[model samples]
Target: MKTHRLVQNFSGYRALICALPERSTEALAPTLKKLGLQSELIGHSPAAPVVLPFENINADRDILFIDGDMTLPMDWRCLRGAGRSALPPAPVVGLVGIEAPSRLKALLLLGATAFLAKPVYGGAVYSALFLGVNEYNRKEILVDAVDVLYEKRRRRAVVIKAVVSLMNIRNIDEDVAYDLLRKESMRARLSIEDYCEYMLGLRQEQDKNENAHGERQALKG
Candidate 1:
């Protein structure tokens, strides 16, 4: 539900250019410098597979310019972080030399949010950076929302358990129990599931204490 503001300026961002030495990347570095981005040219060979610095990539500070003309037999799974989303660690702008579907598909698989045509022009660099960064931001927002949904789903069972427990204890209906939980959760400034989990934990501790006390009393008797 949160709206992300579009990133217009790319100041202090690092552009990681992964292309062969023979590729026409001359304009890229200088253009990026004008936009306040530090450029690092990653050397790649046409005969050998491209090795991307997957671990070193930071979504906030790094943008990738990948050469689509070259073949990269990389394990796409490495791009995923702890959340296991297929998104790249940073914004990706594919360098398109070949207009073929196969080449484009490779870029897509690399999670290219924007594209730069072959023979990088200074005119297009800004646009590519803007689009790539903003698109990545949008995807990140969506991924965060998905993560929240998954967490809420996982805690649904806990909510149910709490509702049933409250109903049985207070001799109330399910609706009343649930409403009580919602009110309490609001007062506690926690999600319904989170409040329920906390309440259940407290009840568990109370039950343990009572059981221990009873055992001691019986032993003394």
Candidate 2:
């Protein structure tokens, strides 16, 4: 149920160019500069394999410009088939030269949200940057939501356990126990699962204290 505003300003973002030194790339740098983005040409050559700076990539601060002309080191087809990470660490804009399906597919696998045609038109740069960055943000938000759903599903057992414990302790029916738990969770300003976990923890501590007190009394007797 969360919403995000699209990022309009791209100032302080770094553009990481992962392409061979060419006229297109040369033209791209100044365009990025005009948009207030600092450009860094990564060392990529046709003779040598392309090495993506994966570790240094930051989703918040960096935007990638990958050459669609070059053959990337990793097998995109196999990676996608194997269910490896489809999304790159940063937002990517494909520097597309060849209009072939194979080349475009490679960019898609690399998670390119936008494309700039070869020979780099300065006018299209801003549009490409805006689309790429915002699209990446949107995907990230979706991924986070999926993770939260998975976590909540995993904690369902804990919630059930807490409900059972409450029913036994209070001599109440399942529905009443569940309703009580829901109300308490709202009062505590926590999700039902989280509040149930907290209540269980408190019960555990109380049991430990009671056991210790019983032991002390038996020692005196």
lDDT per residue (tens digit) for residues 105-190 in model 1: 97887789999998888999999999999998998889889988999999999999999999989999999999999999999999
Q: Candidate 2: global Cα-lDDT?
A: 0.83
Residue-level lDDT of model 2, residues 1-221, one tens digit each, is 33666888889999988887888667789988988999887655556755566677788899988888866464444312223434677888998998999889878977889999998889989999999999988877887687689799999998999999999999999999999999999999999999999999999999999999999999999
Best by lDDT: 1
- Backbone clashes counted, model 2: 0
TM-score of every prediction relative to native = 0.89, 0.81
Misplaced by over 4 Å in model 2 are 1-3, 72-86, 207-221
Clashing residue pairs, candidate 2?
A: none
The deviation in Å at residue 141 for candidate 2 is 1.8
